[model samples]
Target: MNRRLLGAVAAVVALVLGVGALFLLLPERGQGPAAAPASTTSAPATPTSTTTAPRVLVDGPVGVPTRIEIAELGVDAPVMAVGTTPENAQEVPSSLDATGWWRDGAEPGAPGNAVIVGHTASVDDAVFDPLVDAEVGDEVFVTGSGGTVAFTVERTETVPVADFGDVAADVYRSEGDSGLVLMTCGDWNGNSFESTVIVHAVPTGA
Candidate 1:
């Protein structure tokens, strides 16, 4: 994936210099959490349409995402602001219990994609272990210092890591109706994985 976004690159540099937390602009092979093989199962592909039912909008201050919850998946984890690493790739949280929110991008409930990433397998509990089982129409919620935003799953896709260029538009889309994306590495077995699991959802209500 290209680290062409100027804002993301700048944030990553700042994060590394000040906080000392490493952030990568792209997925560095052999540097992330342990990879696990994805179970074989027939799953639906990405939705062709972005159409969605009109959702109630919140007319107030929007806060930075602080946490994310997926009730069906038993996920209720902290959200930390993350930028790119010195290598110019997306940043991953140091702890598996936390999910990294792309700080340089849109916030939840805003007119763009708000991204959150996590690990599929961790030393403790797998944070996104159940992400592959996520189904369209499932519920997801994000809370920040500003407020809470609700969303409903619209699609799930597993894309080969090398083919990320094909879906770069959707992943880096910064203009559109409010949306949320959850991502984690998958199909990996200790060394390498073929793809990543991306859960796409849209804001439904406050």
Candidate 2:
């Protein structure tokens, strides 16, 4: 595929797998987070009655994400907006301590999927290393200039690089309720990551 098309696909796939060539150069630390044990099905589970709280709605205009926090994982990091690179790859944060939010995608607590990508590991500890320990029902809080939106971990999936294009379509879909997608490289195989780990979340009133 052409670079532009590939980049677009990368953005979508990154929503789930945080695919990036740079990550390959970094030394391996440990295995990527295993898929949340609760996620057994291939498809994302629809939010059911278990979510008793009303979905948090944007009070006014959606704000750009400024920070992301996962109490369960003890993650508290700054966020920067980023787009695709000239090579047609999704742009990632330069610092391992921060994360990059897809500028063209939905803002948190808005109408569509908001994607955040971070490195799984770097020479020093990376921002998202703790993601490998994430589980369903974990809470992800995204702070914006406007306000904060809370999301509940819905599912996690690990897919091969070759198959990410198909999965990307679903991750980037905009028809559903406001959602969050976290992506990171998964399963290092010496030269490159054999797969990508994707975490799906939905806004919860809390």
Candidate 3:
């Protein structure tokens, strides 16, 4: 073929290839065609209530106490972790000290009954807040390093500060089980006492 003719054919082929490449890379902007979506794109997954595990959980060491969280009222706070010692007892929240129930008992989610004590007075209004709203069968979720432990509210009552044993029925109810008990001044609403709110829960279903 002649040189001019060969060059013209080569130019036509180059132009076609260039146009095809542009279409593959760039989408038309103004009054052009809509860009096709990527076929490999995926949508986000939604959360579901159906879970394999139980709804309530307890967290922390087997014997070392930590924080307590109640989902019903968004009550997540750093609980004063105390065993049965003068120093450790002093560390207990003043509002929670009236009750002798200390860490000498069980740690959260442990084998035995884990007892936590708090106060109901408002000198600082620092504990047992909104205690009047608690109800039976309410689930209390405790959390720590171990995991979350679940408990049901067995009962709540008011008693005199002198009446401590009344709660023993609720606190030391059963044996050989994991449980949690929360006590606040409910005996007599005086200098350091008020309605004692006690929460009892155990491994009922699982």
Candidate 4:
């Protein structure tokens, strides 16, 4: 999308950076753990309504996602709502075993894109360590208050850090059928990653 559109959605879908231990900029490998890396990607685009019909907000538990499962990759982890940090970047889950959902973005199974993020590596095995191995057609299941929503992976891209902003805008934009996005660090270079792995999926019916 355009720069103006990305700016408009900045408040709702802030970019997620400096997440996980991999993002750290510590000394070369074998020295010690790394420090958090500098921000790389830009904020997301505004999510448009899925339908042209009048919008209606449903009260009560509106299916807040609780867990995410990718059987093909042997990933099953708890999901938690995460908001932006004081600096406006999205916050990741403190626990390495959990994944963070962009709370201000679209809800899973809804019309917009539901963005979920996990660390590739941390103190121990991170929740999305195997995400880079995910392939097209893999099944991703997200369980929430509403129920479970099934998505079929459509594609995967390893985007250079400098180009992440454009890719993120398309992945997180809310102008299409219900969809899902999974993100993590990529291309380890001893000290830090040079790229970001982004997986795009669509609802089973879509």
Candidate 5:
């Protein structure tokens, strides 16, 4: 496959993953507070129901993310909006402490993969310096006008410029449930770009 085209496609796929989940209003993905100890002194005990509380998901207007916080990685950064670059590649955040979410895809709580891209290196601290260190099950919190949505890291991989097709299929998938994909350029491999680091996460309930 053409290297440049593949690279560009991967970038756009990442972009799609970022925006794909923007509209889905998934229930908060965390365990709620423990139920209070059953009343021990009550003369008559009230019957306890087994049903779980209904999950309340508020679908707000197509929200533009304002912030993203990954507590495990100590990454709390502002999110910016971007589109394609002049070279036709996806545009990236200009600052190291910020990430750009492609507005072309679904809004944050939506039912598709929302892609968030950032730089891995710069004169200052890389916005995603610890992204590679992220483990499955880690939490990613995105806050927007709609509300804060929580995502749990599900998978991470590095895709070479030449083998972008497989990952492209995965990231650009529109048939599945809501998800998020975080992307960044990794070490250079001499030909084009070295590889792309991607993290796939899904809304979590804890």
Candidate 6:
């Protein structure tokens, strides 16, 4: 996220000064309460579309670095997943910047939305940040233990945080297209309930 777009959050945490949270810029995730892996060692991220298990976040569990390849922006970075509730959303760095779309609801290629998040403001947006340029017909892929799930970029838009809270049908819903929202700084002003940058995409194939 550009400093100007980051707004107050950016003001408080500036990458310009190189004092911002590096973890914050690392793409993150947010899902409903669910038991998952406790914790694990982190490995380096590569360009290989290898599907691997994710590291666990045990109580502020560090989000595993799941690589994201955006063919359009040429972005490649590891996106982190976090729990959606207030208790965990901010706790996960990956989720804080560009949190996960939430998996329990729908499998990437199954149906519903397959969301993911990451910081758009990075020294070099190798991953989640590139979503800013993602437009309809673009592609976003995530490699996890299950496998590689690719999503076609539907469109990008900002919505009230409250509305994004449990997406319904019309508000934050998309059936004609797979529902994948890569949310980020939208208001670039408010600290809360600003706006959400939604990069709509669907699973292309494995």
Q: Pick the candidate with the highest TM-score.
A: 4
lDDT for each residue of candidate 5 in 25-105, tens digit (9 for 90 to 100): 111123221211111111211211212222233443237776788999998887877654333344556556677776666
How high is the lDDT of residue 18 in model 4?
Answer: 29
lDDT of 5: 0.58
Residues 66-183, candidate 3, lDDT per residue (tens digit)?
A: 4555667545555554432221111134322222234445666666677765444444444455455677777766554455566777766654323433344345433466777775
* TM-score per candidate: 0.71, 0.71, 0.56, 0.72, 0.67, 0.51
Instruction: Flag clash pairs in model 4.
Output: 23-37, 24-35, 24-36, 25-35, 26-35
Error of 5 at 66 (Å): 1.0
Give the alpha carbon lDDT tens digit for every residue of 1-206 in model 1: 23344222111111211121212244334333222122211122121111222333353325676667899999977777776545445656665567778776788888778888776662335567788899988998777665677889999998766565556568767887778888876674544444677899987653
Per residue, candidate 4 scores C-alpha lDDT tens digits across 1-206 of 22223431221111233234222121222332222335443333232221222222232123677778899999988887776544445666666777878776788877778888888763347888899999999998787765577889999988875555445557668666778899887776655566778899987656
Q: In model 6, which runs have C-alpha deviations exceeding 4 angstroms?
A: 1-65, 85-91, 94-104, 122-127, 160-178, 190-193
Q: Please, what is the whole-model Cα lDDT of each candidate in the order they appear?
A: 0.61, 0.62, 0.42, 0.63, 0.58, 0.40
**Candidate 6 — worst ten consecutive residues by lDDT sum?**
3-12
Q: Candidate 6 versus the native: TM-score?
A: 0.51
Scored by Cα lDDT, where does model 6 land?
0.40
lDDT of 6 by residue, 1-206 (tens): 11221211111122321111211121123322222222311232222222444522121111232556676877655455443332122223332233343432343444445445444443443234555566788876665544555566756776554444333233233234444556553443422224455666655542
Which candidate should be chosen as best, given lDDT against the real structure? 4
Candidate 1 lDDT trough over 10 residues, lowest sum: 9-18
Model 2 poorest 10 in a row by lDDT: 36-45
